[model samples]
Target: SCLTDTRMMIKLRAANEPLFTGRRNAAKAAWRAILKELGLQGKISTYQMAKKWDNLKRRYKDLKYPPVGMESVADGASSWPWFQLMNEAMEGRLASSAPLLTPVTQDDDHAPDRTPKHRPRPAPPPPPPSDYGPEPFGGGDAAEPSDGPLGDLERQWDALERDRAALDRDRAALDRDRAAVDRDRAALDRDRAALQAERLWLERERAALERDRALVEQDQVALGRDREVLLKMRSFPVSFSVSIYRPVSEREPFAGCRPGGKPEPARNKAEFFIFLNFILEAEY
Candidate 1:
């Protein structure tokens, strides 16, 4: 059951954390997606999934940091069924005092005994009658070394050594996690810079478009003034001719026409102006 639970929790954490977009609605959407992916939308609600994860975290914290009066987990690894799995899942997210867990195999538990076997020896023969007055060291010889207080001291030393090793492993893991976080920060900074560049490019394009629009407006205004001038010119008769004849007595003289004897007819205003100019020249 613990294995199954841990596996489920791992999947949920993976799905939710990556899909979340920093919004409440997005988080709910991520939960829904996770439920759909796991085919548990109908059986389990998002609230339940959240509660289960919280419970798992709480349990992990309890094991990692036992109560004040209780002894710490000096064996390096916890005895909790799914602690190792949870540790892997929450590796960079949670702060844990526990060390890396190594599962014990059957071979490790059933290794061959290495303690030396006690061999029997023949009884020592009685010492020869001592002529010297009561040998001082006859039966007062000290007993062979027995593993009492010394053995306990050795066992404590071994436990302390294990605790130190576990602490070293924990420190190394923390260092690696820190490195990963720093990498993520650098990547985020690069992305921010890219987004800022894109924004500036959009602004420049918008400004260029504004300038083009202003030029187009000016052209439209010029065309409107030209249209008004052409409308005024259209008011004149489509066909007209002008011929002016003056005598030499006048200050201006007419050319190609002597006192208006005969003048060429003009078709349009342009030809009429030319005929007028010729008469003025003749008068001069």
Candidate 2:
């Protein structure tokens, strides 16, 4: 089936969208979506879509601006099916310094009679936008291989993606380290609390020991006083006194004390006086 004017316009408009000029993958995806929307996915591959867009732009540029010697070349572009649609889509996109018409000099007018006028080939379209890189339109003219700005942008995008992946890995590692640090801090706090409790208990035990020591000191002092009193008592002399009653007759004093109250023998008087002197000396 032939593509209608409406379908050609749709293709031109879709190709000119910003999404079709982004990163390679995104641009290809956008082109696939455009093809799917046009119900041409099975018939037209993504590569075909890209090539079609490139060819359209090249044709539009050729028709819009004829080459140096082909001033009247664009005269037939109006009859082309997609020319108007491409012109509309590519409005203000193509930039050129070449004059649309070449000035005729009197010497060149006279020299033109020597040969038939030849139509020069149209030049390639202007470079794409700086932000966008060249799209890889496979099967395009080999002269217009996918290179230049598009290749540089693709490489830069790839580098940026690699850097982003590295940063993500670093961020994940940092999060894990932070979690471990928090756990370690919690453990240290628990240890500190336990040590504080143990210190308090030890202090209480020390206080109790101090009290016991004080009581022991007081008991020692009291014991020391009691010991001093006992020492003094021991150092003092102990004496016992006995009295001997001298009767009218000293020889008969013990005789009256006898159980029968009988008179003592005169020979026992000397021994009795000696016993009395021994008791007196012992008392002194």
Candidate 3:
């Protein structure tokens, strides 16, 4: 659509330029002839005619007349002729109804360029005013030393310090409790070691006692065998014999003589022998 509008504007510009030139020249020539007929040759010259033509052309070109209607242009160069014919037809129809148009004059040096101008940014809003009200220190009227509230804050701080001290004492107590537990655990370990050692000693003593008992049992068995042998030996007994010898002197025999007594036999070399045997028996 923009392309179409641009092409139409180009055609309109081309057609209008030539039309304006021709009409303006014709008007200038007619004015010159009228001046000549009035016998005022000094008033209008060829230069004056050209200047008037230029002014008329500018006036007509600035007129904002709408195009009669849409016209389709197949060829680019043919658009000018077609646009001229259409514009003449539209102008004839609105010759008496349309208002006269004036051109806008522009100064080449002072006129703003086609580019848009950048407006300066407005200054930031001023900062809000400070609120000066009654502060914790004192009112804004005068500086006054605080007596009650300051003392209350100091008391609160002191209370906090006391609480912190109490927490420290509790922590110390817990540390002592932990140390006592550790000591108890060490003592328990020592006691276990002693008990283990005692158990080992008891086991060794039990083994020694078993060995001694075994030896005693062996001794008892040997003593019983000896007793049995002795009993068998004493079951029987046997025994034996005796022998005697004597010598006497003759004088002794004479002294002991009596009338009816038998005289002792004269001492003489003599020998006698006797043998006896005995046996003893025992019950089973």
Candidate 4:
């Protein structure tokens, strides 16, 4: 049961790897997610959880070593169908002796494969011994000299071929990268073109608005002149009249007036009934 739980926990960690991948707290996030799934949140720190994981992995590796009596199983025997079946059972069901350490040999699944450490270059074969030159001895058996100029030449050719292949790969990668850059540049150009078109449309619209505003101003000025002229025309009188009032006191006579357009002279102590009149004129 503990084994199953540990496997589940490991799987949980792997699942959450992408949750915070490439970020600063990726490990912390991964461990936290694992703990949450395992129902161990707040019960253990990520450091302690990682330590536990390392311990389990170490135990699993120990279990992967072949059992005490399996020495007779030659390395080539592993490829045999029965050996594969045995591996499967050990890795799958844990019913076999190897899987007694299921932490390592569960269902006979082979240990995780690792790349062999790079062996340093074989130090260029000592420059093919320049003092020996071409070996004239050995009855000129040219095909037999393993340490001769031919061997050196073959090595050099192999090295050149490797370099050429590496260069070809680099060139292909560069071409792919350049193509991606070109696609991005084209997209940028398209966006810029769209923006330019939008700007031009806006400018034309603004110009049209300006022209309309100018026309509205001119119409307003014309309307103002028409209103002023209409006011003057509406205000003209249809006819004209001039009124004159003559205030003549009875006690003092109307000394400046005569009844029938006659010139009158001044009088003393005279009383008379005064009259008033208004003159009217009509115009077409």
Candidate 5:
């Protein structure tokens, strides 16, 4: 009885074998088609596929469950929401990590509003015709006359005349001072010229004195030479002597000589003649 039951079970499975084989073959072909379409056949490991599915699920945290069906499994159980969430998360991460890549809003990206908040306007002024001229003395229409204490226009004219006279006086005084300065300058020039002439005269006098001194020295030298010649002539002894007694007195014999006899001393007549010639030349 057990062998018969085992045979019956084998026949039953063999009778539906084609249908089961076809289902398994179709499942294999579908998986190959999905891997080829996603281009992750041999490149993606079972562990890597599971990690990608987990990451997708985490990115779409709003979704409570993974997508159903064999197509979802092939695509790592990812849906449109999952992709959108992942993209948004990547954008947020980029923005936080790099300040330069911050998302820009349309309103902020456009030119800012530059319209002024408030306008400036000039204040209105009083009418021109109503207050045309200066306000009458003290805020009244009829101005009080200026005739109290001080006269009117005539007194003002007199004051102006006095001021003009005083100015004229000052101008005349300044003119006089300028003339005096001119006279002083002229006097100084004259004095300088006189001093220069005096200096020139003194220089001439000094030159004349020098010339006179030179002439006097020449005369002194000539006198010394004449005295020297006279002394040379005087040094020789006289050969003759002159008798100073008159002829009548000569009857008495002269001293140091014999009367009417030969003279005891001989006289040098030639030296005496030369001495007399020198004395005569010197005297002339």
Candidate 6:
């Protein structure tokens, strides 16, 4: 996304335009048309388009590839000479058509603005042979002169180049850090997904356990009724197993309790009920 957008902005700025509002509006209209082509007309609005463009412009405006031109950046508090150059270039172009910068009357005027005087350029030196190439190191005019404004400008440019190199290194380090952060975020996301799956499994197991508990409660109810009927019947066999009709010693009817731990003989239905509940706890 960044590559494609930077390329597009490079093309638009090749003319050295500051990309004012009218141009941005035109670009926004073009975007709407593109959305229409993509069958996304309903997802378009002027404010949204303008906002996207504004954000892109603010972010990419600082993206100077080699950081050669425009030495100063105006951070909203003060004016810079580079901004004056841009304004001069713009006004120079607009001088022919637009009448916005008109002369003010004496009554309306506060003070005359001091425009910087531009110096005329010197004539170019004769070109060398095409095959000769650039001047060699420490040879001819390739060396930095020790005086004059030109020398100062050269020193500034070299300093800016060094600054740009440092910025590039910082940006590369930030990219590596961002990649590591993304990897950690992806791993965290995987762990979160795994936790969600495990929680779901636990929920299913709890539901199965609840169904088993319901079945056990139902069995207890049925077993109580069966015991009541047996107690009411004098023909009840003393040798019967509590779980099933397996044979046991004629006296050991309490599902083979501990030796000599035979429950006292029940005298009534209430005692029989107590015995039945005690045996039921053993899953009899």
- The candidate scoring highest on lDDT is 2
The 0-to-1 C-alpha lDDT of every candidate, in the order given, reads 0.50, 0.53, 0.39, 0.44, 0.41, 0.42
lDDT of 4 by residue, 33-80 (tens): 555555554344444454454443333333345357754434434333
Worst lDDT 10-window in candidate 4: 275-284
Show the lowest summed lDDT stretch of 10 residues, model 3: 132-141
Once superposed on the true structure, which residue ranges of model 3 sit more than 4 Å away at CA? Answer: 1-150, 237-284
| Candidate 6, residue 29: how far the Cα is off, in Å | 50
lDDT of 3 by residue, 185-239 (tens): 9999999999999999999999999999999999998887666656744452322
Instruction: Rank by lDDT, highest first.
Output: 2, 1, 4, 6, 5, 3
lDDT of 6 by residue, 1-284 (tens): 43343233223322322222233133334433433332333333323323333333333344222145643432421222123322333234423222122211122211122233776587798777322122221223223222244434533544543465467569889999999999999999999999999999999999999999999999999999787665654444443334233222444335435557554434233555765675565444
> What is candidate 5's lDDT per residue for 17-80, written digit by digit as tens?
2222222123223222332333344433222222333344343433433346423433432433
Worst 10 residues of 1 by lDDT: 102-111
Error of 2 at 174 (Å): 0.9
* Higher-scoring candidate on TM-score, 1 or 2: 2
Better of 2 and 3 by lDDT: 2
Ranked candidates (TM-score, high to low): 2, 1, 6, 3, 4, 5
Q: Which pairs of residues have clashing backbones in candidate 2?
A: 133-150, 134-150
lDDT digits (tens) for residues 1-284 of candidate 2: 34452444244344435453334355445554554455553444444445556566676678788899887878768666667656755553322211122211111111112233797688899666322222332334323323334445544544553465467569779999999999999999999999999999999999999999999999998888777766654554332112223343533445345456544555356556865575454444
Per-model C-alpha RMSD: 23.4, 24.3, 46.4, 24.9, 47.9, 22.1
The number of clashing residue pairs in each candidate reads 7, 2, 1, 7, 2, 0
TM-score of 6: 0.33
lDDT of candidate 1 at residue 79, scale 0 to 100: 47
Q: Which pairs clash in the backbone of model 1? A: 253-283, 253-284, 254-279, 254-282, 254-283, 255-279, 255-282
